[model samples]
Target chain A: MTTQTANIATTRTGFGAYVLALTVGVALLTVSGMAQATVLHDAAHDQRHAMAFPCH
Target chain B: MSKNLLSSAVFAGLIAGSVAALLQFLFVIPLLLEGELYETGARLHFLSDGMTQSEKGTPGLGGEWDRHIMTVVFNVISYTGYALVLVAAMGFAKAQRGLELSANSGLIWGLCGFIAVQLAPAVGLPPELPGTPAAELAPRQVWWLSTIIATAVGLSLIAFARTGLWQIAGGILILLPHLIGAPHLDTYFGVAPPELSAEFVTQSLGMAAIGWSVMGYFAGYFLSRSED
Candidate 1:
């Protein structure tokens, strides 16, 4: 990784977009990583196991 | 978000998630199938007479067509989510710290992500297998998330900090979650053989490392390409 030191205000991809991406990303993770519904758990059982999420 | 950013993230995620699911299908699922049998009492590792049973039956890819599809779908979605966070992080690293990550360096970024999300947290809560008795789900999830966050923040600080004091603080952050400890049941027990359980954890982590590194390369590739 190299360093460019571009000003945030005039950056290539604005900081707001990165924040937005972060928000949407975390939401998806919450669904896959933390949802507790039985249907959800059953569907994601193998994935939960593979990803090492805590499961019943 | 730029169209380029979104598309790049999606593309990277699709490839990464697919690779992860493939690895699970090939190496991890068979063990899981075997472990599940032990979980359901369909197979017993320890006989009542104290004579250890070596093996009863091979794990099957039974005709659970629907369920299998769901597993595949979830794996893809999960990695896509992970890729979004990763690429956006690289973007943040550039915007805030002036770190420019090219496709090549993305491998290191990916490894850092693996450590923060998998390896570091696993120190406290090792990857669990089917039928392994565990503590309450809620507390374990909380600890897991805390460990991931602390490790991620700590690593970036160490990587970006210019001074020794800041680096030491980063080390402490990485250690904080383990020091507190993962929540666990009072008694240690598992229906699956200890050997089987250990393999599941090792293979899962190994697969994740590869998946993350590939995703990081693509994410960085697209992100840099998008800027051109």
Candidate 2:
């Protein structure tokens, strides 16, 4: 591959990974936010509080 | 992501998460347990034997080994998740802007992360103790999300934007969330005393700031070292 081709490939891969990371981060946070008052919610309870996400 | 970058992030996450966990165990957990005492009516602030008092209840952490383990697991996962986002952003910035990511810059990055994720939203929504009453969840969540995104973008512009106009725009974005205001109940109803709640909020934010600083340091250190 030419150097330009390699650069394009690298950029594409990086963009893909960045999107994946962002999606995962958003999903994790949403799950935590929408979690009902259950053990799973409790597991993340302190963190939610510490992060100041407005849990009652 | 490159293997080295991924590995560095994992290593940083593990170490940073562990440090945060240990600090939480030492400093924050006790306050939580104490707050729970108020939540469960296990402890009262001002009442004598002759005076009327609510019946005591089991402490929150009592016979809850599974819950404790879950907290540890959750914390590690949370930090790792945060590290993933931070490292990814770091990579994108470097690739797009030719910005440098070194251990020194990591500290600032981590602080920015803490500000974007914790402090900015917190300005509107301070940490709450267990059993504290709050507004409906959905709206609060929306406001919180917007606050984080706005603050992150705003801070980035303030730091990275070359021109004064862009910097002013960033400042506006930072304040926009607060300008809209966080959802809150008309009435304040807190089972825990104001003092305990105040202490909990202070300690919680303090501990988190430390954790983010350490995580940023390690992430930058490892990423730069890996490059070398």
Steric collisions counted per model: 1, 0
lDDT, candidate 1, A1-56, per-residue tens: 13344333235676778777777788887788668888898899998888898766
Task: List, residue by residue over B44-149, the lDDT tens digit for candidate 2.
Answer: 7546564534443324456677766666766676777777788878877877887788989999999999999888887888888777888987888889889989
Best candidate, DockQ-wise?
1
Candidate 1 local lDDT, residue B64 = 87
Report lDDT per candidate: 0.83, 0.76
lDDT of 1 by residue, B1-228 (tens): 355567778888888888888888888887889889888998888787977665744476778889888888887788788888888888878877777768988888888999999899889898887888889888988899899999999998899998989999999999999889999888977877778888889998999899898888888888777665
Docking class of 1: acceptable
TM-score of B-chain for each predicted structure, in order: 0.94, 0.90
True contacts kept of each: 0.66, 0.45
List A-chain TM-scores for all predictions: 0.70, 0.57
- RMSD values, in order shown: 3.9, 4.0
- The deviation in Å at residue B34 for candidate 1 is 0.6
